[model samples]
Target: MGALALVSAVGLAVDDRILVGVPIWAKPFKFSVSFVAYSLSLAWMLSLLPRGRRAGWWAGTVIAVASAVEMALITLQVVRGTQSHFNRATPFDDTVFQIMGGTVVVLWLGALVVSLLLLRARILDRAMAWTVRLSSLIALAGAAVGFLMVRPTPEQLATDDSPIVGAHGVGVPDGGPSMPVTGWATTGGDLRVAHFFGMHALQLLPLVLLVLAALAARSVRHPRFPLLARLADERVRLRLALTASAVYAAVFVLLTWQALRGQALSAPDGATLAGAGAIVLLGAAATTLSLRTPLP
Candidate 1:
């Protein structure tokens, strides 16, 4: 599935087409690559659970189908030279939009179920268990952000000619002064920033833990290693993972808050700066304390 998505992304990237002031192919291209990465990460994490292979297969199947459907609809729209999301321009378009929305909801629910399963299971590695639980929850929160995009803001309803459902940008309309490749809003609040960060937690948390595990393994075999091995103990690593997850969650919340308040990512004011600084300091302190404390 990942390979297929990658191929689709490459194909779309090479295609010469434009729609609504941006490359129409770029939407599916980006989504394809994201889906590939997401699917691979999810599969790897699910592998950690006992008797999870079957469960993973079921969950992965559902997600893959839903994601493929979504990409197909978006790509179809691109081929037709029309908008895929929040477009109720016509009855047919509205139906397609509804299908896409429904498919995404299913995908989100499937993910939630997998997360619950992981949480309920009694895994041996405490740090990995916690990492899976926290990352899944964070990813779900990110998925929930899509709801905000689905519900039309008052500004969108008043301004757009079509029956507006939702938008990506806040303060300014969508498609205004976006960042380079990702096209996230630079001059206005873009919910995608939060969504992107939140969804990738699954990959980030586990990857960090894996690196710690590797370092710990290396230190055990090689006593001359400079870094203290005590910090690499399972308990300390668990504490560190928990602290990191908390910090990750804080950042997600801050981004969501900033977007809701119509603040641009690149143009955070004094309050935003102060709030972000405080969070960073707290994260640093927690990490330092976790590293210093001796395991009982």
Candidate 2:
């Protein structure tokens, strides 16, 4: 996957063919980079299993293979100088789309299995155990946000013989004004915003915990008091984890809702801002409350 990312980078630099308002290699490049991170995170999570090691290993392997194949197909389409997603101009293109769709499903189901296994496996740090388990589940919800793009848009529906079925942009065409490198819609609601945000929880949540742990490592040496020890407290850590995950889930839902309503992430209306403010207010309140309330 890393090699693919490097190759895609070269393609991005040299290949000038533009598709979907971006370089032909841009999609595959992004996909390759994402798969590298995603595959590594899942592989690490699977390694934590004291149980289901074999099953988890095989599942991870299958996921890696599926992701690789999906990336390969995207690259192949780039070589053919055509779009990959939502492109049904030809029969082979449609088949490739279907195959990539199946790969996504496979990856999601494999993660589901690994998450279930993690819930049953024993990890030394109770907080980290929960973080790994719940993050995977949260990522599951995030990955699901992509389904919103698979359905035919109203324009597509209006035309019975439309070659393109759906689009990532809600109120605008896919190739319109987009964020610089991400290619996410800037002019209209984009489902990929939530989808990308949600999918990254698998890595980000664990990273947050690690950062907290690092802060906790320099515990106070005072005889009677330990200032940093609370950062490492199992109960405190668990409370923070649960609170953070809840907030993450809420934000994911809010993003999904905002996109569904044809709202851009960069330019939110009053309603969108209110929803976001509510999430921020609630998250802060919940974090404070979690610290105050004792965990059972």
Candidate 3:
């Protein structure tokens, strides 16, 4: 699953049409590698669920189906050498992307939520319970941020030309607003920045939570170390710190580069920066809190 996702992401990056008029050959390659790494990590996680839980299996299936659709759509774009990014071709295309994306997110959210609920029900071990709860928190936060970023609105589909009619040459020019900034209280570029950071939160939040879960599990198995022992567990702390910090730093740098390169920074740019900063701080806080709280 990771390998496939990586391939799709890379296909997305390299495609010139996705970048709103700018074309870069190497961009796709970069996306390809990055996406592969991220997807593999996610795949590794989905593989860890117990086989006995019917709900978990179903959730995994849903996620798999959604992911497959996403990959196929993106792959088609890459293979056809067409620009399907953001549904540039047709409204349905973009809608499909959103639906698939949302489905994947929702399924994962459901799984995480269910896991936590089960843990609370005492159907899971201490370490497992803590892991699911923390994971659900992160997943919920990510979903909230993502919904904000891609919330369906008039602005997102605002178009000067009727996408359907224009293709057949039966529509007026300058039909309506194209990608309006009204959905969010900021400029287009700023919103873009906010969206970028928010969407990626899907990755960072889970990574931290899962890593913490792994550490706490190890501590629980050790007879000498108890609750505080888990808290003082340097291995987990170091891993969490390094993973979160590295990912955040890299994303921050890339976002800055993208913004600067596009020269899209304006008054709202400050707002974008603030949004991204908030996300970073939120992730950091969540990780810190989870680590600080000893396993029960």
> Could you say which candidate leads in lDDT?
2
Error at 53, model 1, angstroms: 5.2
TM-score of 1: 0.93
The residue-by-residue lDDT of candidate 1 on 1-296, one tens digit each, is 45545655675668667665577777877787788778888887677778666876788789889998998898788879888999888999999999999999999988987888788878898988999899999999998998888767777667757565678887767778878788888888889889989999988988988888988888888878746585568899899899989999999999998988888888898888988999999999998888888567
Q: What are the Cα lDDT values of the candidates? A: 0.84, 0.86, 0.46
For model 3 the local lDDT of residue 13 reads: 61
Candidate 1 residue pairs in backbone clash: 152-165
Instruction: Count steric clashes of candidate 2.
Output: 0
Cα RMSD to the true fold for all candidates: 2.0, 1.7, 9.5
Ranking by lDDT: 2, 1, 3
Candidate 2 structure quality by residue, lDDT tens digits, 45-78: 9889998999998889888888888888888888
Candidate 3 structure lDDT: 0.46
**Model 2 whole-model lDDT (C-alpha atoms):** 0.86
Task: Tell me which residue pairs clash in candidate 3.
Answer: 2-40, 6-36, 10-32, 13-28, 14-28, 160-175
Q: Per-prediction TM-score, please?
A: 0.93, 0.95, 0.48
Residue 23 of model 2: what lDDT? 83
Find the candidate with the highest TM-score and give its number: 2
**Residue 163 CA error for candidate 2 (Å)?**
1.6
Worst 10 residues of 1 by lDDT: 1-10
